[model samples]
Target: MNTRAGEAEAVDLQVQGRVAWRHAIRSLLAQPRGSIRMYSPDYADWGLGAPDVIAGLDAWAIGRSQTSVRMLGQRFEGLQRDDPRFVQWRIRFAHVIACHALPEECGGLQECLLLPEIGLLVIPSEKSRLAIYCSGARLHAAVHAFDQSWEHSTPMFPAHTLGL
Candidate 1:
């Protein structure tokens, strides 16, 4: 994706699968103020299938005022059972939103992050696996898909449980 705004440029990240995924998670963790929205098949099966990333996402919900939403594919059910992030966000009354659905639910994609004021759309390339941030109706539409899923999916706990 080309960076039309000049302020938001997609960085071509070059690293091993594990390293890149970890870096993405770390980036999400460091930015405590902004929100993180991701669509993945299963965190357990994903290359970044590590405990710390889950912990970090959990920490994000519990520690920050920001919102974090996860969109799980259809085959992904109860995948967040042991995830600290799921526990922290879903049960501990943290600021978070979680959702589950089939590939059709996610509008067909692996991962995405919708940043604040940046419009929408920061996707990882299939070949390069690098992150590309862009702005347009496309991102807006993807975010809409996220919103739809979040509204429709079941929470591990309850909305009132987290006061969300």
Candidate 2:
């Protein structure tokens, strides 16, 4: 998934599993004024790392409010079924944290993380997970692309908790 052409440091993270993915996401997002964009089928594991990710955002928000995380996901079944952690995080950080449902036509919009500050992107590699450690200009383009898709997505987040 290191689609970037020149000098892209991409690391496959499939073997690294959820914990590693969680820690890397948590650590990179530690500093403030950074943006995170994630696209996953159901965001199953991202919820597992909610504490650290939210903590990072909390630290990042120490003096500012504009900083936040935007997620573009597909299925809401798993997220809505029994994941209370994700529910809680979504509620607590409702203002700075938001989730949107991207249409199926937006193919390849699944299982990726875009961290602007460190030029990082975590993507799937067919048989593995990928971590594009540093791809400065490339990440910006991806971020822009993700934002465009975000604009078209519907809000299925707290709405997941609607009838409860």
Candidate 3:
């Protein structure tokens, strides 16, 4: 990955295996300075909760008040149970990070991460443990699609749960 004045150059790469996917995610997380949008059925096999990914998010959002991380998922029960570290991180950055539940109507949404400014888009296939990295027109289209889904999503995964 090459950076021109802190902006990553558009990249096109095919990533295979869990390790490569994780690396691609980390690289994507490292490049964005404005906002990051993600859509996944459930972050079950994705390493969004891994130390490095969480750390990258931490680094990206620490002092950047303008930066935002928005995530959309069909359900979060699995994520809540499987990725405690990510839940904790989300709690800490609740102000900057938002998690939403994808509306039932949008059940067929694909798993992707969009970094608009840098034109980076990541489409991951959990079953095959493969991912595609692309930019240019596809990235814009993905951003539009993600925005549509996000607009219909409901806020979820609150920072705190109130129990009586």
Measured by lDDT, the strongest candidate is 3
After superposing candidate 3 on the true structure, give the runs of residues whose Cα lies further than 4 Å from its correct spot. 1-10, 117-127
Q: What CA root-mean-square deviation does each model show from the true structure?
A: 5.9, 4.7, 4.2
Please give, for residues 1-164, the per-residue lDDT of candidate 1 as tens digits: 45666444444443445456556555544443456566654554342334565565555556555445554455443555645444444545444665555445445553555654332233455664444443455556667776776665554433343344
Ranking of all predicted structures according to TM-score, beginning with the best and ending with the worst: 3, 2, 1
Q: Rank the candidates by lDDT, best first.
A: 3, 2, 1
Candidate 3 RMSD computed on C-alpha atoms after optimal superposition onto the true structure: 4.2
Better of 2 and 3 by lDDT: 3
Tell me, by TM-score, which candidate is best: 3
Two-way TM-score contest, 1 vs 2, winner: 2
Per-model CA lDDT versus the true structure: 0.50, 0.64, 0.75
